[model samples]
Target: MTHDPTDQYLPRGEFSFLSLSIGAMIRVLYYRLRGMRPVRVGHCKQCGACCRNLHLFHRGKWIQTRRQFKRMIAECPEYERFEIMDDPGMLLLFSCRFLSEDNICQDYENRPSACLEYPTLDLHLRSKVLYPNCGYSFKMVKDFGKTMKAVAHIQEQAEDKEDADE
Candidate 1:
């Protein structure tokens, strides 16, 4: 299948508080049903890459136009800390204003949850790629083959119980 570069900037679906919440719940349930999970490893290297290079999402999609960005900022005043660095037509890139020259967050103590929870579990579930030099990485919580076998055994037992009852 041909991959569209702009596809990465598109929202997975229509944006709404309920939709996002339900999407996250579904992702979690999917992994649970598969008897699989992702585990984050490593700690921040303080490279400042995350803060220096950010892709902002607004409403339900990547900020594609300046007007959309302005609307986002107007709705989220705290987003003012991020300054647009480029508009490559399909996407708008931003960088944090509080990142210091020494590769530190000047407002670390008051940083947004997005910053504090960098490399969130959703990133792993969505298979989002991180910076090449990023210190964090994700690994499966259990061996895929083993997990699948266990899930199959549980299903078989449930079927057996139903048959006995019938």
Candidate 2:
């Protein structure tokens, strides 16, 4: 079988809020059928993975690397003046520009809604893709609040094994 990667990421059918990406649709169906919801691990660990792995939504994908971001800015001239949300240190740290020396958000109280909803599944998203050291988990329930699956997800098993190997 042949594969066209572009066709994978591009959304088919009419583009609208109701329509979601294929990956997101799968996750949404899973959670809706199983009644899964965000279950944050008690207390913030301030690991800063969310910040370091900073993701920006653009062109039906997440802009992660700086080079990609620069290209995005080039393509969208209006974005050349994009708002700066992080602090200056982020340039050197390559984590979150908003993170303090101790890994706390410098503007925690005034952080954007996206920041406030760290790890929360968005409209088109449902997977519980947490950072490597994030203190968050997903609780899947059925039978009216009876917990079925409550797993505190850490790094991927492959990563754990890789670390063990080294």
Candidate 3:
């Protein structure tokens, strides 16, 4: 499903990043443990929607003003590649300078990590949405609800058996 542009902005801080990364790792581990692997689906449509509509964050908050974006650039010079596209009060949207008129990356090979990792499951988990019309999605190998329930039932039975033995 498409995420509303007005939804809460994702935080950008060391702690927030770490927590999200850890959570994503845990989620992957859980799936692996359950024998359910996640698979990436769909190919890029080259629509440039991702390049044109970006919700950037810095210092645990969404960059809401040009001043804040400027500060971010000062701190991370590489961020200068992004330009402010709009500020709808709540958040500032950005566009990459490398995105060309033909909806192509001018520097495809040298794109930023954010660009390379667009539509990642970690991002989806954090934002609960993806760019509208983007041709990418993720899905698990299989549903694990029944498996987890069965596991819990087996554990409960084992615990009961031990208690009876005691």
Candidate with the greatest lDDT versus the true structure: 3
Candidate 1 has an lDDT of: 0.65
lDDT per residue for candidate 1 within 46-122, as digits (tens), equals: 77887887766666565778898899889887778988898888777888998888886777556764565566555
Global Cα RMSD, each model: 10.0, 18.3, 9.1
lDDT scores for all predictions?
0.65, 0.48, 0.67
Please give, for residues 1-166, the per-residue lDDT of candidate 3 as tens digits.
1222232321111122352455676776787677775555666777888888886766656588999989998997777889888878977889888777878677765565466556656666556666777776666776466678889999999999999999
Q: Give, for candidate 2, the lowest lDDT window spanning 10 residues.
A: 1-10
Candidate 2 segments whose C-alpha is farther than 4 A from its true place? 1-22, 34-42, 58-60, 64-94, 122-128, 143-166
Collision count of model 2: 1
In candidate 3, position 139 carries an lDDT of 66
* Ten contiguous residues with the weakest lDDT in model 3: 7-16
**Model 2 global lDDT (CA atoms, 0 to 1):** 0.48
Cα-based RMSD of candidate 1: 10.0
Q: Write the number of the candidate with greater TM-score, choosing between 1 and 2.
A: 1
Give the distance in Å from residue 38's predicted Cα in candidate 1 to where it truly belongs: 2.3
Residue-level error in angstroms, candidate 1, position 65: 2.3
